[model samples]
Target: MKKAILVAIGFILYGAAMWYYLMHGAQADLPVQFRGSAADPTMFMNDRQLKLSYDFSRIKDWIYFLSVPLEWLIYLLVLGFGISKKMRSTVKEVTRFSVIHTALYVLLLSFLSWILTFPLRYYSYTISRDYHISVQPFKGWMKDSLIDFWVGWIFTVLTVLVIYFFIRKSKKKWWLYAWLISIPFTIFMYFIQPVVIDPLYNKFYPLKDQVLKEKILTLAERADIPASNVYEVNMSEKTNSLNAYVNGIGSNLRIVLWDTTLDKLNDKQVLFVMAHEMGHYVMKHLYQNLIGAIILSFFGLFLGSRIYSWAISKWGKRWGIKGLSDIAGLPVLLLIFSLLSFVAGPVENAVSRKAEKDADRYAIEMTKNPDSAVGAFQQLTISGLSEVNPPKLVKFFLYGHPTMLERITFLDSYKHKYEPKELEKAKKQQR
Candidate 1:
């Protein structure tokens, strides 16, 4: 109990330090032209919008920081109170089959965690709705939540079965074996996500605007991406935010734009957005991200295995865990991995931000329409109510892409640098 208290206090202090940094740190400085001032009313958000964005961002950040500590505490409570042990015993009494016992135990554990964390999820939903960002109906939201719960359970059970299988077979080298199997498993999930999983929540179909579709295809052709179609998903029902992305591998690869994007931006702006998505493919960002994730998982799993062993050696009996192979010890593994993920988030986000910045540059060069690129980013900010320049710590931790201010400034610089050269070349050709 004292250990748990100490752990909780440590996490709370960490979260507090992060919050303080976000509130007090200097934000990104924009050029005078792009700054939100009386003279440049159209450049960025106005005073009221800025305030709202700041407030919304703060609330969201608080929820995010609080969630990790709360999750850790919940897992601690479950272990400390022997809830996981009770769950395992109950499942074992009902099934003699090992697989069935593991599945049942995982199901109960997932359900309990889901129920415990539901208030946070619902509060997040409410905040989105209240801010007019989410338009999903309550029933639809609950249905999606239930779907997530079940889908998560299915994967959790599979993973636990695989991990325990190796643990039973080779106690010393199970982590290595598990990591090996995970490589293909991770690839399989990525491959099937667009085809098998994504459609469960939202409908997707080929882009309906033939003219716009042709334009996007032209950009894809310019980038030498083997895309046969541009897909549009029905996202307006879920949120007012705008997004476009490239997902899947090989035949399942898709360039997807939210319907909200079409509703919000003009044709040229949409093309620029499409160009950005195509840049991900052109730059091989998907494969790069996949490799990075696998590498991170390798290190994370290695460290987690060591930590899990140490933890069990010290506290297994107290927590009713029999050994490292025991299914009841799953929460310890989860708790360890979660801590690793939290610690590694800033590094991960920084890498992602760099990739996004590269993609933005690719988009601008491909389209050669700085105005449209700037306008697309502006519309994104307006529609999403994004903060143009978030605090340094907030951007480091939460932003996976450059802030609107950075993107717009980049475009402005790109125009100044390249437009003159293009103009001179055109004049020489005329002569």
Candidate 2:
């Protein structure tokens, strides 16, 4: 009994220490930067200033060169860790071991990304082409690739260096800086991105249809969201998949729609989906999300600081990662993110699920066409092969929203509630 009590106490202390480290130590090191916005030429990506052009082949090369090793390393670690279960290690022992292993992996990855960022210019572009998703030429591709690499490198190095210094000066407050950095970084990335990043990936055409523009503005007014602008991004230039997102904030706001979404779905379905996106805007989910992210990232970094920093400095020499930009170390970082993902994953999913459920409710109420909403839900299910059944714990830990089955079930219940009135009303209205 005493031993069990001690174990419980130890875990409690560890949790508090983890919280303290993350909340106070590492927040300022990472910040939210990229986001979607209407009218912003860079709505889709930081293509222009970042120098992105569609060239999936080049992206494939970069990933092949840089991200692949990390991907494989993570795969192996998962397998190794699972296999070690037969050794019957206690959870605490595993936790400590995993923490060390994950931290070293993350350190290596950070250094590798710094090194391979230049190649990222070509990297993302190639991904576009190789996937048959790109409509960009090589010249545009090369230019964009370089921009992506350099800008990405600058932003990354600056933020990382800042956090590293803070970690050095005050291990206890590393998480505070992590939270603080997200505010400025999110704003800068949001505004400059229209100019710096998106032009390289796809063309931005102003909403040419005055009538459609007027309708969108009207919709925004009805939704109580201001009309920053509206745009039809040439997503067809890159891919035919449909999507829509309400981008930017305040003056930077806009309803950016992909042509594919326009082409595929009818107006009602589009409005239903747009309403969901608008739900995010009205709820200010993005900002809330930023805050949450800042908090979580700090947690991750605080837990990881000593482990990763030590590992990087020590093993860095062996892998030829003399600088933070060493491309070879990316896998290590991924391994860390993969490992720490267990905790943050649940927190993130909880927030997202709340937001998503709220939006689903809003869409149902606004459209007043629960049937259409149901159809849309079906579309999502079949389109994705989303599992209908998942363990409750899995939903808690991994799911960002209620399972699709639950969503469908809710809508079905809704349908049953008004079936008689709905049927009679439909018949009367038709007459």
Listed per candidate, the RMSD to the true structure in angstroms reads 3.1, 16.1
lDDT of 2 by residue, 1-431 (tens): 46446654764565455444433432221112212211122332344322322122123333433343344443333323332222223333445664343333333444444454445445555555654455667876666656665665566556555654555566557647755775677666665555446655667777776665676667777889977577788777555446677766556666777776666666666677777788888888867876676667767766665455565587655544443333234334445655686657777897898898888777666666666666665554332223343445446655787765566556555665556777999899999
- Model 1, 142-167: lDDT tens digits are 99999998898899889989999999
Compare the candidates by TM-score and give the number of the best one.
1
Candidate 2 achieves a global lDDT of: 0.56
| lDDT of residue 224 for candidate 2 | 95
Candidate 2 least-lDDT 10 residues: 30-39
Q: What lDDT is reached at residue 187 by model 1?
A: 94
The per-residue C-alpha lDDT of model 2 at residue 123 equals 58
Off by over 4 Å in 1: 1-42, 418-431
Q: Return the TM-score for each candidate structure.
A: 0.92, 0.59
lDDT for 318 in candidate 2 is 54
